[model samples]
Every structure is written in structure tokens, then in C-alpha cells.
Target: MKQNIHPQNHEVIFYDVNSGYKFLTHSTKTSSETMEWEDGKLYPVIKVEVSSDTHPFYTGRQKFNEKGGRVEQFKKRYNM
Candidate 1:
């Protein structure tokens, strides 16, 4: 570990834009924006577009394309 040459290690907040979910994590990244978390301390808030809270896969809302009814076509083609 070098002395004073390294960037500061600080707590960061990742905010999910879609779900308004936030969590604390440590990073070397810096930001001007901050938030007071449940621990009663201010941390850098970084906003993200997606998180598991609102993600389709995690929410069980994920959709799959029918591929133009390919399943039926495949069964018919195979006569199975």
C-alpha cells in the first residue's frame, strides 16, 4: 500500500432507478451527490437503470418470444 498516492476508499450507494432500491457498498469512485442512509451517514449515490428488484427475470415477468409459433411447427414437422 502506497502512502497518500492511492484514491480514497469510501462508502457508496447504488440506487436502482426503476425500483428506487438503494444499497451500500464500498468503492473508489467519487461523486458529488450524496445521501443519508439508514446508518445515519452520508454516502455517494450512484443511480442505475436496472436492479433485481425491478428486473423482469427476478420479478417473474420475463417474456419469451414465440418465434412465430415455431414450437407447434417443429412438432408438426416431426409428427411428434
Candidate 2:
């Protein structure tokens, strides 16, 4: 493997915008913004609009219009 070719990964904090949730993870991305973590150390903070905490699929809150489903539409059109 080539040395010094990969971006350095650092401890980062991801803040979910919708849910106000924060988590610690390692990433190659960086930001000028920093925040003090629970350990009292400042880490680069990344703001995200969505994460597992706020995603509809992960939260089990995703809704589909049953009346607009393909199966329902096919059945209605075919008189099934």
C-alpha cells in the first residue's frame, strides 16, 4: 500500500439536524466547526440533515399511501 496517500481519519461528531442527536465516529471529512464532546475534548462537528435516528425507514415511520399502491391501482383498473 502507498504510504501517505490516504486521507487521515479523525474522531468526529455528527449532529443530526432534525432529531438533535449526536454521535461519535471516525471519518476522513473535516470541518472548521468544532464541538466539545462528552470527554471534554473538541472534535470536528459535522451537521447532517438526516441520519439513522431521523430517517423514516430506520425509525419505522415511513408511510405509503395504500390507495396509491400499484397493486391497488392494478386491481381497480382490472376490476379484480
Candidate 3:
């Protein structure tokens, strides 16, 4: 493996916007925003739109849009 070819991983905080959930993890992603974590230390915060806390699959609130197949959609679109 080539040296210095990989990005550096740092302890970062991911904040879920929808559920207001926050978690600490290591990632190569960095951010300019900072937030005080539960450990009483500041860490870079990366805001995310969705996380396991609010994700439909994880929350068991997934909605199935089983409106048939492509043919059914086409028919519905044409009012057939």
C-alpha cells in the first residue's frame, strides 16, 4: 500500500437534522461547524438529513408505494 495515500480519519460528530440525533464516529469527512459533545469536548459537527434514528427502514415506518408496475403507472397517468 502506498503511504499517505488515504485520507486521515478523525473523531467527528454526525447530527441528524430530522430526529435531532447526534452520534460520534470516526470519519474522513470534516466540517467547519463545531458542537460540544456529551464528553464535554468540542468536535466538528456534520449535519445530515437522515440517519438510522429517523430513517424509515430503521424506524419501521417505511411506506411501500406498491402502485403496481410500469404498465400500471402508465395506465394511471393516461387515465386508462
Maximum-TM-score candidate: 3
Write model 2 residue lDDT over 20-76, tens digit each, in one string.
Answer: 789999999989999999999999999997788877888899533345678887999
**TM-score (C-alpha) between model 1 and the true structure:** 0.59
lDDT of 3 by residue, 1-80 (tens): 78999999989999987667999999999999999999999999999977898778888995433568889989999999
* lDDT, model 2, position 53: 85
Residue 11, model 2: Cα distance from true site in angstroms = 0.6
Write down the lDDT that model 1 would get: 0.80
Q: Which ten residues in a row have the lowest lDDT in candidate 1?
A: 61-70
Ranking by TM-score: 3, 2, 1
lDDT of 1 at 55: 74
As a whole number from 0 to 100, the lDDT of residue 16 in candidate 3 is: 86
CA deviation > 4 Å runs, candidate 2 = 62-80
Off by over 4 Å in 3: 62-80
